[model samples]
Target: LFHTLSFFYMLSSFTSSKISYHYHFINIRKNWTEAQRFCREMYTDLATVENAKEMNNLLKSIKDLSYDVYIGLYRSNDFKWHWTLSDSFYNGEIFKNSKHISNNESCAAMDNNWKWFNDNCDSQKQFVCFNGKICY
Candidate 1:
């Protein structure tokens, strides 16, 4: 019985160690591009959503936005939509209901239903930071 308990405890510790909550919140009034640059200066990029869980965490951490906040999704120089911070190409796994406000809108935003929206990168709003990094 003691050996079993010890094994469970070890398992629990191992699991917890693999899981990391590196999210950091930042309230800044800056344009999307500026915010991205700010995040880059901090050694990590903006919030990248690899799944729904990360998306929800980001949404929950952010407050009510009077304006759209810039997310990590954007068009690459190749004219393909890609996450600004992630090496993995988005396979349309998340933000399936996303819509573009206008074709000119380059930055992605989390709108209703945690959907993505393309808006002008110059819009002022609060942005989120994650991956053991923070930016003003």
Candidate 2:
């Protein structure tokens, strides 16, 4: 009976977590900085490409042209790249093949193959917002 109860508890937790994986797509034209702030004001900060699966999910959610979206990764005051969503350092090689180049590309997005690339934050573009909350 203990095993059965534990199994139900695990299932409930997993279901709740699944319901909270909210990565919303917002269609609007705004610079990266403004877009980042907008997301925070509305609910969460700029979204993060948490994983390839989530990235693919976003790509499918996009309806129009995949505009460059502002992510939670950016250059710090010291010029080191970091996640704006949290203090976690960005060790992921998501943008290894970017040709646009340099720290000026303050925004990140998933290109055609679920890869990350940098873009000018000031450039107006549509965005995907991530809110880790259960949507009713």
Candidate 3:
């Protein structure tokens, strides 16, 4: 009912010895779970959009924005938002109390308008992947 997305980022503002990875946009469409599996096997994990700059950059990376994509965001059974890739694996304080259209919308995706929305986790769509050991 939902597709997965891939997102990669680098520490550009600061200096680091770790490898700087890039965000790769996979055109292949797959459900959120499938996309996450693929990303874990090949790259780091699904794309983790942190700030407005990253979101805008991610939207711009996709040449064709006619369709939405699955990001590395999801909701737990208890209704907590989380990113796929993280060291501490902290829960997202944001969207903790936000209302959604449906309780079935447990996955997060970005539409063609560069807007984030709740979606069914089974929806298949293109995704972005992140790469790098330094990224959170």
Candidate 4:
């Protein structure tokens, strides 16, 4: 009986700790900075694609893949890649090519192929936002 109770407790804890996120695709085209501002005002920060699952979710949320969309990825002044979402779980698996050849290419966007690429921040594009919830 004690073992069963412990197992149940563990299962409950595990289930409760799982983080769930709802992705929202905004079809309105805007620059990366504008998209980030809009996301912060409306929902959470711009979408953060951490893994294949998140990428798949993002792809599914968009009805049209004919155009690219801005994501939360950007390069700091030091040229290090970072996400607008502070707690993003990035493991470097989604970038098709990690090389950023141009210094002006600081912002990132998702292509039709679901791969990420660097782009100018001022270029207009649609974007995705996410609202994350911690289940209890």
TM-scores, all candidates, are: 0.63, 0.64, 0.70, 0.74
lDDT of 4 by residue, 30-74 (tens): 999899999999988888654445556777898677899998888
- Candidate 4 RMSD computed on C-alpha atoms after optimal superposition onto the true structure: 10.6
Tens digits of per-residue lDDT for model 1, 1-136: 1222232232221211222335555677777778888877873777776544454577677656454567777765454567675455553423233443344566776553444556777788667666643333
What's the lDDT for residue 85 in model 2?
Answer: 67
lDDT of 2 by residue, 50-97 (tens): 444544565566645454555666755454556566555554334434
Best-matching candidate per lDDT: 4
> How big is the positional error of residue 135 in model 3, measured in Å on the Cα after superposition?
7.2
| Residue 19, candidate 4: alpha-carbon lDDT | 51
* Higher-ranked by lDDT: 2 or 4: 4
TM-score of 4: 0.74
**Which one wins by TM-score: 1 or 4?**
4
Greater-lDDT candidate between 2 and 3: 3
Q: RMSD per prediction, one decimal?
A: 11.4, 10.5, 6.8, 10.6
lDDT scores of the candidates, listed in order: 0.57, 0.57, 0.67, 0.69
